[model samples]
Target chain A: MIDLYPTRGGDEPRFIDRQDPVVYGTAEDGPIDAGTLAGFDRDGFLTIERLIEPEEVERYRAEMRRLGRDMRGDERVVTEKGSDEVRSIFEVHRVSEVFAELVRDPRVAGRARQILGSEVYVHQSRVNYKPGFRGRDFYWHSDFETWHAEDGMPRMRAVSISIALTENHATNGGLMIMPGSHRTFVSCPGETPPDHYKHSLKDQEIGVPDEDSLTALAGKHGIELFTGPAGSATMFDCNCMHGSNGNITPFPRSNVFIVFNSVENACAEPFAAPSRRPEFIASRDFTPVL
Target chain B: MIDLYPTRGGDEPRFIDRQDPVVYGTAEDGPIDAGTLAGFDRDGFLTIERLIEPEEVERYRAEMRRLGRDMRGDERVVTEKGSDEVRSIFEVHRVSEVFAELVRDPRVAGRARQILGSEVYVHQSRVNYKPGFRGRDFYWHSDFETWHAEDGMPRMRAVSISIALTENHATNGGLMIMPGSHRTFVSCPGETPPDHYKHSLKDQEIGVPDEDSLTALAGKHGIELFTGPAGSATMFDCNCMHGSNGNITPFPRSNVFIVFNSVENACAEPFAAPSRRPEFIASRDFTPVL
Candidate 1:
């Protein structure tokens, strides 16, 4: 098959136009309204305040804390490179019922199905925990590049929903996405080493776009920080250029992140990597969410 | 379109021999061993001691307590008849991450897929809470009957797994199943009333087998109580005649119960009811567990 969004091979990054549509379904066909759908299509992302209730947010925060503490030795629990603090707990929906319910919630999964125009399944799920002082940053990159190269995801028919479990303020590290950057797929260059995810989960160094490319994308599209109260959420396209800064604030930051993939675009063999990432990191289970 | 396992709208209870194979997959193709598979085929159920670790059991117990305390007034929380005590929480896998992880656990979902010989989805899941003294009895009946009549489950291609979160002693009202009773599908007579699950969940009065039929089945197969320590699990066929008495013991009995149905046997229109039961009670989501 042709590698439309190729990555992890070569010396310089390659930019390619996105071949997929941003919004696959119309408001007439799903729970989202036309105006909101249009806005999402234009910017490649959308933020909703209070997408979940306060009680639900508290429950997820509790679950996040529990998993962070209990899953210390588990491989799926990725820790910060420098500190032992947990950076993310992968496959959280499969492990946590609170996040699992959120993955199936209408505001999240319904919108995903609508955006992809098909039944959706979880490709990946995690509780990103940015602890108070020593929290680390996740470098800027397109999720689709890694999913395609390392996880064997066939296309950009996926959407990610990150729901805030704690209040996200300017000081606390929150997600920053380049509006309209999803229109272009930045194919980072480098051969993915064996077991790349083991290191990448903690500190990604491979397949990161060059500084020039990052600067160009940010300059052209502009960066937007997703800041909102607990229970707020942001849904972004798979190829959106996004990352977060390290949190040094007194207050912690946490979110339940879920990636919903279209069943029609199920994964295949990796396009660039030596092997596919683990199921907990990038699920091979393509059973569509109903 | 014929009603093979017909119930309700009939005058007398009808007993039909199970038409499907009990063990669908060979041990060589699945995680279960040949000896265990043979035993399950013969007795229609198998119990594995310490199916989960003690720590995991305690975690689930904690989750159970939390759900029971906080889920009041939620429709999915079924209170005991004539009391405000929470009897059961339906679609528990969808509501609580702890139970959801238990549902996806290899010993649970993997064994289910092997027994059904197909990718399986959660047909129903609930945390059965039988508190001391006020805990009500769940009358003897084949789960397949209610599923076939009200939920439109087509065949006996489903299995139920109950994992004890607390020590299950005789006094605490553990499950009791009629050995080899699954071979006979006792088609109970009576038209299924609309919204039957509302009453049936707390205290079942509908789709129950006649006493004579139950007596004959018990007389032939004999009854066995599943008494075990916390973390032990029992997997039983859907058509097995089973029930549990009220717990009068101070040590309350609770178990995480999940039903896995083959993806091939997804629900159709109600075979004998006015409308299908709600999604939480009888899930319409047919996404197979991977």
Candidate 2:
């Protein structure tokens, strides 16, 4: 492990890959423009205040609730509290039409292409159900690290879009991401921690940066919380360090995450050990999310 | 359902979407020309005689054989015989990196993009194994028809690359395609029949054209069997009418099939009832494969 916390610090940020076209488009509003693109390049993430409509969000939330009721299999549907409570539904797109449509929505896919300059495929799809009172904490970690070490992915060419299906505010433990941390490539060691696949009740640990190191990194880049009304969507680079706290508020935090990886940099299974997670969770089908 | 068989007997072909840039390149040969592009447009398919070298083909075949040894789950590993023989390994890309690389190869993806004029994602992947003694027949049908009705694929904007791993000739029951049938959009009916998933031992039927319909179609626009040495790769449009015969020869007919769909034309779950097939086999991840 490289202990990637930056020593030198400033509030001001440095941006790279400025020339690539970044789209500032939403589901309600069709086309994207140049200014939105620039902001994304500068921050390594973009926030669409209202990407999905409220009605659609309600419909999907109801669908998620229905799906959570019937979920079977090894470790797909997990929980912080035991006995049928929802935590996350792995690969929700396959089971629900609404989720599938969200993944293929041109509003999201168009921006992904603009940033990547290549065809894109969904690396993973999961619906995080952070129920009030018992919701658990997700320790700080970069997604690319786990993908590279465990799934045999060769590069950090993916982006994850977290769409809020419920109000996600600071009190409810919304996503907290380190600003501009995409520039700091962490050399994380170890395979996917065992608890990552199933429920995180016993252990909420997978490639978590040590506490002191995390404190230092947070001090340097600072942590930015993604809190918004339902339908708000945030697109973050795969390498951006992100985590969420345990939700104790009455408000539930539910979000659908769709991660897009560039086709040109598609991975081979690099790890010597086979993945414990099933195909649906860590997808092998690299078809571009149309 | 509209029975879309042609009316008259002729070898003449019709072309559509004439302006898109189609590639003439292959793995062995790097550059493509206008003449080759025109041929693909006219015939609705292309043939790359040696996409994989001999050594690579042998490695993949050995890997496939190894995979066949211990396949768990349902009809995914279909066979001509009972229990554990090789007929087709659905989603072979998921289990083996060699197969994944083969599907994502620039040699394949480049031509697909050239013809499609957009980003491409996989529709499906399978290793068709026509075993020596008990290989069965594949009835006449177009792939797009099934995809449109059963999988919610919106259009025929997809292509399949079939590469011969074994000697694909007449005796071994090679692929039989109706040239120019890409112009004939068939309205296929019925769900994926039982036994189409796990094995084909019981029923060899699904969306096959009736005898009169097949006779009229074949009579008007003759069927052509693909015959070539190992390593020969053929790319055909999704709507191209095709099927294969049963084999009794000692030499088996095995081929790797990769289907690519354009991202712009991706679809919702269009079918009335959901497909019974597994997600890995049919694929819901529309992420454009780079």
**What tens-digit string does per-residue lDDT give for candidate 1 at B1-290?**
67788887778987898988898988976778999999999999999898999988888888988988888899999888897888888988988877888888887899999999999999999988887534656778899999999999988899999988888864445787888999998988878788888878876777988877876886688667788999999999999998765543345688888999999999998898899999998899999887
Off by over 4 Å in 1: A1-290
Q: In candidate 2, what fraction of native interface contacts survive?
A: 0.00
Give the per-residue lDDT of model 2 (tens digit) for A134-211: 465666677766676556666656788899999875445678777877766554434444435453333444444545
Model 2: per-residue Cα lDDT over B76-142, one tens digit each: 6765555355667787877788888887788887777767767888878888877753465565667
Q: How high is the lDDT of residue A176 in model 1?
A: 78
Local lDDT at B246 for model 2 = 54
> Once superposed on the true structure, which residue ranges of model 2 sit more than 4 Å away at CA?
A1-31, A72-74, A81-84, A189-196, A199-206, A271-276, B1-290
